[model samples]
Target: MTETTPYDADRARFTRQALARLVLCDHAVAVADGAAGLVATENDPDAGPGGRVSQAFQLIELAERALVSAVTYERERGSSWAEIGQYLGMDPAEAEERFAADLDGWNTAFDVPYRLDDTGLKRVPQLPTAAYDPVSACARLDTWAGNRLVLVNDEHPVSSGLTMAAPKP
Candidate 1:
């Protein structure tokens, strides 16, 4: 008789989320480059190969980060090397070695803690979004500008000056 292990809900969910994030990362670069019309051409030596090389590098970096994080999460959750290896389609030792450099790089770059502190769990960081209230933004702009109004995206240059004033009696 064959014994089947139940599907891991957490692993499945995390894998889905990681893939989504990777897609979003690539999409974001494409969108921004498209909007700016910053396509690299053969004529321009500075912007080589339609920015494809750079975009590919970015994608690779993002993928590495996600893979390392997921592996770390699995390890923290008490997943055995054999299980991780099976999921990665490799030998147990090879699986660990494959992710070693990426995991080390991630550890060096980010100071984020894997475990909870004495008080409680750490908060998840928020991703950037386009959502904003213009009213509040304008109010903040007014406060920042004060008496000297700075026109945004206008011909007139936005300037700031520091003036010394005598102490009031």
Candidate 2:
């Protein structure tokens, strides 16, 4: 079997650049901020493209951060390792084994089951639809936005809002 790849070639390169910026600023969000925070944790050249588990886990972490978006987001509806791997022509079980290493740390809280659909927000409104594809939808939006506004659209549990603790020192 081929070794698991972490991210696509372009993503790996972009992440390398982002991480380079992020590391220089240390771990300060005020100094780092938004996409900068993403860049911060990704700067390890030692990681390489095949080290995407590290990068994906970091993104999984930051997406849940409230100060960043005030809402926990799960791209499971849009993207998952198994799903991505399948799209890339790999076995789901094998794909998971290669990149699921980060689950040990992330599992401390909760790790979501990959869902093909969370009741069809795609077509049936409240029922799961066989035809919905979140990844494709987001891809179109990104293209329409001139590739400037990239996002992983997903369903969120509605809350009154969120409360955040002070950033760690």
Candidate 3:
């Protein structure tokens, strides 16, 4: 696969992907909100307790995923665990543990091979999430980013007793 592309084209592609993701997220939130309302009101037998229970479960899952997404975004933007902990009214260690699922999802989403800098910072290139191939893409990233160690940090699933590895090149 060719990596070279005009900057404008790359930006346009990124814009489209981002917009799609945003729209989907908005729709999910709206659905979850509607479910919340339904669960709070109405008792029609056709859509009563059972339906409400199902909707409530879905809302919980959606809320969890949203929390993960938000935490991951904040972490990527260079927010420290202490900063995030303050925002969540928790200690740094508690915050890390609570957001473990979020960190795991973020790690999987961006698990392509990368070479971390001296400060454990890797300038990750924006890749299209569409048709994402973690294996081949990580191999390509290794070539582009060189051989450098990614650090064990709060964003890693390893912090939560999970292990991850870059795909074989």
Candidate 4:
């Protein structure tokens, strides 16, 4: 048997993929907005306001990605998300959420806690929430963001300890 290899798709192919994604996105959004539930528009449906919004959002994000990729590749063509969104009749947030799941590359960009600039001001990205202090502990971020907080201060959890009893036989 012959071994299989991965196939690479270029810009045109990527663009077609993006368009298809937009139609699906619009369909999802459309189902949400109208008084008619999703079933009403099941088989053959018209994409209405929500669909229009999603479509615009998709174009906005596609434009943004194109501009970003162009800037990375060509360097002459460059634009920000805000600019692209403006051209697409949407906003920065809309453009962002349109490509929300596509935002995998910049994940670790904010992972570093602090940075020292030439001016010597330290930039810290993470901040403490009601659940846990960002100043200490790695576990806190997960714990805090995951559920409702029973204890609201540093002392509560830090001071918390379990009293051991005999294990049931």
Candidate 5:
């Protein structure tokens, strides 16, 4: 049998919940940045109301994506459909049915990590950029979390003890 390297082990341990959380974190960062931009433009004499409204609309879209990711994360963490449905004010079956496709896609991504580009020269990852590159995701997420959480101060604060080294080619 072949020896299992640290990277392989880490990758194996990176469950669907972890991937969903990474996606959520990425979306959260984008939403935060977009909100900041909207605030900055609020008082800018050169910024138009129409542009600010457009930016706000984009932020709303991002927030919706983040909500989806949050649901995915919760499902992966053993949350019951009823529990999730309660928050959305819908039946459990309806809630599950609504998110079924997204859940299926998330599961399928692991089986088919990437696809060829039109030229067949470049491979495009099926998972979100952060989830696809878990090593970088861990680092970036840890930094972001550490900066936000007062109790955390070290490198890998969020992903501490996780083996997130890049795989050997």
Candidate 6:
């Protein structure tokens, strides 16, 4: 049997929230870059429109993933399905149904953190890369949030603070 380290337990407790914030931060960065690209294109007469449209499509996909992560975070934090449904303009049952699989997968990742690869020599994490390696996710999300959120202190940003608050199992 594989033993869970103190670090592994801590990571399992907090990775979901960190990953959610990471996705949101990534989406925000991409949106900012897309806006800058649009401005640059506006000034250049030779710039084309198709690339921007494609970028917009990609942003939509990122936004969808961010939404899923947000829902997962909310569920983990004990938010009611009705509350989520209210915000999403859907029935509570529908909201729960829509996100059930995502929440299940998130929970399962904590239980089974990794699986043997096809080669049977390497292990692949069940959680998303950002969630699997939470230290990097915290650093990235905290830096991004610290730069953007006025309430987030530069020295101790949101994600780092959350890591400190991870629940003991």
Best by lDDT: 5
Candidate 3 per-residue lDDT, tens place, 1-169, comes to 2343333332333322232233234334445565657644445566855877777777777776556655665675578899999988999999999988646744553444233456866433333332133333333333332322244333321112212233336
lDDT of 4 at 23: 27
- TM-score (C-alpha, index-matched) for candidate 2: 0.22
Candidate 6 backbone overlaps, count: 0
| Model 3 alpha-carbon drift over 4 Å, by segment | 1-43, 112-169
Give each model's whole-structure lDDT.
Answer: 0.43, 0.33, 0.48, 0.36, 0.76, 0.68
- What digit string (tens of lDDT, one per residue) describes model 1 on residues 37-131? 43545535656665666665666665554566567656644677789999889999999898777556444323331333466664322121100
Model 1 per-residue lDDT at 66? 52
Worst 10 residues of 6 by lDDT: 1-10
| lDDT of model number 1 | 0.43
Count the clashes in each prediction.
0, 5, 0, 0, 0, 0
lDDT winner between candidates 1 and 2: 1
56 Cα displacement, candidate 3 (Å): 2.0
Instruction: Give the per-residue lDDT digits (tens) of candidate 4, residues 44-154.
Output: 357765875565566556555544333222211244667657765889778666654443322222233234566877443321121012122223322432333455554
Which 10-residue span in candidate 1 carries the lowest summed lDDT? 125-134
Whole-structure CA lDDT of model 3 = 0.48
Decreasing TM-score order of the candidates: 5, 6, 3, 1, 2, 4
Model 5 clashing residue pairs (backbone): none
Q: Write the per-residue lDDT of candidate 6 for residues 1-169, one digit (tens) a residue.
A: 2435335744666645556555555555666656556556455555465766776777777667778877876776678999999999999999999988988887887788777899998777777656666677667766766776777556656564452445565
Q: Which stretches of candidate 5 lie over 4 Å from their true place?
A: 1-10, 41-43, 119-121, 149-157, 161-169
Provide the TM-score for each candidate, comma-separated.
0.34, 0.22, 0.44, 0.21, 0.78, 0.72
lDDT of 2 by residue, 1-169 (tens): 1222222232232222222222221222322244443455556666678565665666556544321111012222234655556654887676566445433323322222122356734221210110022223224433433333246343321111112223436
**lDDT by residue for model 5 over 76-134, one digit each (tens)?**
87899999999999999999999999888888777776667999987666677767766
